[model samples]
Target chain A: MQPTDLTPHAEPELIVFRDVSVHFPVFNASTRSFRKRVIQVATGGIVAPDHTGHIVVQALTNLNFGIRSGERVALFGHNGAGKTTLLGALSRIYAPTSGSAEISGAVGSLINISLGTDPESTGRENIFLRAAILGLGRDFIQKNLEEIIEFSELGDFIDLPVRTYSSGMQLRLAFAVSTMLRPEILVMDEWLSVGDKNFQSKAAARLDAMLRDTKILVLATHSRDLALRHCNRALWLEHGRIKLDGPVKDVAAAYFGK
Target chain B: MLENLKAAMADIARSRHYASLIHILGWQDMRHRYRRSFLGPFWLVASTAALVATICLILGPMFGLPPEQYVPYVAAGMIVWGLIVSMCTDSCQAFISQSTMIRQTAAPLFTYVARVAWRNTLLFAHNLVIFPVALWISGAHSNMNALLAVPGFLLVLANLAWIGLVLAILSARYRDLPKTIDSVIPVLMFMTPIMWKPEMMPLRIGVKILQFNPFYWMIDLVRVPMMGGIPPGKVWVGAAVVALVGWVVALILFARTRERIVYWL
Candidate 1:
């Protein structure tokens, strides 16, 4: 793909993945010992080398993609079609097995928003932990603590352990803390659908403001309407390959078969 | 190579940002361990006290050693061993416990190991309150040289850091490592000089075997300071070597295979 098509603006390319592939090796549970299994593989034993066991499953195959500064791109794909893997590659959560993925700007991922939050920690404490996991410095979180608490709308619950909060409350707290700090490259994997109707609109406006300041926004979602509303460009991934890549409207139509 | 070490040190120095995160996690872990219980962290002290009492009662008489002498000895050994074993067991689960974080976030992988180490250190600190009590009860001799235990404690912390790094990375890649450590720690406990004094062992066979066991060296290092004695220079040198080698090997492994750890998980 050309640089213009991939990274449209004059802003520098923040993330680039050339011929990236992610493969997971399946292992047999019944194998008596690791050495014996290796020996069996070395010998001419008729051990079934299925993808389910003792074989490799290619999750992403020779994928080529790039995200430029100040651009919001939506990665649309079915389940197990490498959408999350591609987003993970940009965040450096999952390194590409064979190809190079170079990301210049700082990246913040909203995938698994509560991944770093401790169940026994207060919501206020979890904010700091989650912020650090998102690469925000401690001083920054300390400075923005009040704003995060206000945005989360968890007044009294802020001091309670996140485990005490309901799922919606937990999501609000996590999202509020995550968005408190601006990142050069912001990544989201279906974490935006956390708030209620009114809160969703508020969150959407906040996200729009963030997108304006964010150098690059990579979101992986199943929602075509949301992608069209927020993302300037769209990528359609099918079977671990980018089937189509272009303007949001055209890609959404193709993806939805409109 | 020196530049890399400098860079690593710089990274570690700036790690306070990461430490704040670990502080939260460590606090959460400690809280979670005793959330349903009323006693909380005191449970660790109580358990250590009970074990010391039992071992002192049984092993002291069986070995023809006085309770006054063996009580402090076993107490010191058990408390230090508790710290070591806790480090070992917790390090094995370090990466596995934070698999979600590794899979989802772009933060440094070492943060999880630090969380485990910090949590165990907190527990060890709580358990250490018993040391003075045991000393008072047994009337063990106190000396200026015994203050060297502070450095000994730091050495134990450093050893835990190395072990945490190695085990976290290994267990992340190999799912069986937790189980392996579970079985290995019991065997290691027996091999270490926790229950029996090293002098009790016959010189030719048992003493030679204990000499080769690194855990024995570590136990002697910790136990010596509490007993108002100096650890041998050889033990100090050997500990330094083990810490250096363990850190170096762990660093190499982490640099080479850190990227794959998330995928493996």
Candidate 2:
């Protein structure tokens, strides 16, 4: 099927979450008995209660939005405002409790770039491991092994475990591996700010390259300028709901009230 | 559903080396465990050796078994049991242990489980060297048929995969699983035929009860090759069937629960 036909009504929206509401049960700590838990739930007690007086932290509440193909959408929100949660839903990290999230194409998320890197394993080995985790076949990693190593610029350190490398070195290696293959849907959550200034420009360039082929890009960041510069559309998530959705500049201005 | 299973099988076949990814991560775990210790990985071998010696000295005479035979038996059992125990316990905490990674990455959760299993498997391999050395030093008969233990070893690996899959998902969703496993494994060890032969049970009821323990079959399967005897067909069939069933159930649970693991954690 042609890509355009995937989401016929929406021009092949890459990611769509329809009226999603994720409610986790909160339970009382003192009553550890099953009967008590049952009673608590029956009486509107939280199934799993957090430390806050509120039984459950409504992480994301009735979130609804769609990103059309080839659109770079920025998710802007304060801490705990569900920007990360929404990004996670898109990445299939967190399935919505009450709604369905449909994606038209393959998604690659840089939520944690170095998810499987071993401190004791050489960079080359970690590249294989990380690539496999990202759903890349072993042969694919093998073919691009040299390219991945060169892009990270670890040179001789490619043989050393990542523990010895500086954090910048680690991020560069991770970023290089993650972006080596273009993904139809790319989700990033504040990973662009790798520590090194030199690597920052390199990372930005790599990200730009990825963006070029990327059909859908959903980036969640608090930086207004970053959102405006990189994204054409912006979504302001407040209290787990979409507070604003429009042009990047308009949403950023409304989100920051500037 | 069959197609999904076929796809998953193909996925596993394509990603078989993903199992080795655990070995690499296990190396890190071993390093982390011995980071500042002067002895490092050697300490694992040393400690296991000491435990085996102590157990042999105390229980060999108590059970009326020769130290020569008993020491190697206990040593091998300890290595295998340690591997299984650590795999179960560690996998329960798999998602929790990598909370930072779980929150930040979109990688499959199974990678963490594989890492734990592989780490324990390597340690099991390291501890395995002690058995041959102990047997040689103790003057026990080292039979060539010990090579037959390869099948038994493969069975244990299969069993471990099933256990890892189930516990990894369960422990991710339930915070209390690791603690529960920690408390129960020693109890399970006592219940199993690790240190003592199943025939040693004085009561018929006790023998029947021990027979019911799946671990008894596993230990007997492996011990047969090492002890230079053919394990009963029942033992092999029973162990294989249990492993297969357990594996299927675990995979189903893993596939169903995996999506919720992140939320639970």
Candidate 3:
């Protein structure tokens, strides 16, 4: 599928949430245990019941929205407000338990920068693992291996185990690897800042370039300054429901209480 | 129902598209597992050799067979049996081990299942080195019939892949299933003809019961050929049928659970 263009024309909606809701069934030790379940069935006790013993946490509730190409959307919410769940649904990690989540663009997620890095593997090996998990091809990874190493500035330490690296260095590697892909839709839990002040600037510059190039950006964050600066549109989610969807200025004032 | 089946097939196809990822993950899993050990994956070879030696030494006289005859028989059976058992037990961990990856990425579910298959296949390759040595020690000649083990082994792997996928999905939801699989595997090993020959069981019922165990047919497909003999036509038919039927069941389970698997994890 061809990527929807950024140049303004007839804009294609890259993401559509049609009455989407994600409900997670809370399965505790007792509920998840097969032996207990079998015994329950054998005893004819709770077997024929409604099977509603397990509680369900409604993470996203009947969400309705659409994101057009070139729209930069920021998700604003307090804790337990479903910002991350909305991003998860967009990343295709959490399929909607009800309704549909239709994403029509290639998605790159910076939700967890070290999502696929194995600490036991060396820095060089982790580059491959993390990139592959981001859906980058082997050819792309191989060609840019040196560039990534140089960008992350690991140099000689790239050959050492990632577990050996300090936390700052690991984040540098993860941030570098994550930003390598040019996805049409970029999804982030929040803005990523890596390493010391020097590397943080470098990481910020890299992220800016990625944001500039992406056709659509959906970031879930609580920072008001970041929402105003980077996002054109805002979605204020409250208790798994969208409280407001409009210009960043208006939503930020309402949600952040300007 | 048909739509679910189509989606399941699509998931399987996507797994093939991510073959490179599977290969890299599988290789990394094996390497990561033995990184600190000096012998590395060769330890797999060493352990297989030790197990075969222990079993042959103890069971040879009881089965009333000479060292040369019984050693190769037990060796072939154990090699195939090791692959079968490890694949079954490891399948339970296939999804659970990749819980983080499954929750974070859009990678196909079978990619994890195939990773387990690929890693065990590599270990199986290590165990295979013992088979030739076993034959030489038992004073058996290498023959052309051994080449037939390739096709037979492929069939066995196909059956194993589906079984592994099914288990991966089921165990992802039921946390207790893996523990149950752990205990059941040892019992299955003894029930299958790994250490004992079918001839050693004098009871006609016992021999007839072996026919009912699909593990026997799976082992026979690879083991019989490695022993320089063709498996019975029925063995070929049985293994193929099991592969086909198991996959149908596996696909149905996979399709139904593909979306819910991440939540279970």
Using lDDT as the measure, the top candidate is 3
The candidates, ranked best first by TM-score, are 3, 1, 2
**Off by more than 4 A, model 3:** A1-10, A36-52
lDDT of 2 at B25: 64
lDDT of each: 0.79, 0.77, 0.88
Summarize candidate 3's per-residue lDDT along B139-242 as a digit string, tens digits. 87657888889999999999999999988988988989999989998899889988888887889999999899989888888888888888888888888888
Which candidate achieves the best DockQ against the true structure?
A: 3
Q: Model 1 chain B: which ten-residue window has the lowest total lDDT? A: B3-12
Residue pairs that clash (backbone atoms under 3 angstroms), model 1 = A70-A215
Q: In model 2, where do residues sit more than 4 Å from their true spots? A: A1-10, A24-54, A114-146, A153-166, A191-201, B1-20, B36-39
TM-score per prediction, in order, is: 0.90, 0.85, 0.94
**Model 1, C-alpha of B194: deviation from truth (Å):** 1.7
Q: TM-score, chain A, per candidate? A: 0.85, 0.84, 0.90
Q: What is the per-residue lDDT of model 1 for residues B1-265, given as tens digits with 9 covering 90 to 100?
A: 5554554454445556577777877877898889879999889899999988888778778999876677778888888899889898899888887777778776677778888889988998898787778878866665676687878878877878988888887776666767888888888887888898878777668888777887777777877887888998988988888899988877776666666777766
Query: Against the true two-chain complex, what DockQ does each candidate achieve?
Result: 0.50, 0.35, 0.70
User: What TM-score, to 2 decimals, does candidate 1 have?
Assistant: 0.90
Please count the clashing residue pairs in each candidate, in the order shown.
1, 12, 0
Cα lDDT tens digits, model 2, A138-238, are 77888888888887889999998789999888988888888876889889887476747777787788778888898888898888888878888988888
Question: For each model in turn, which proportion of the native inter-chain contacts is also found?
Answer: 0.67, 0.35, 0.74
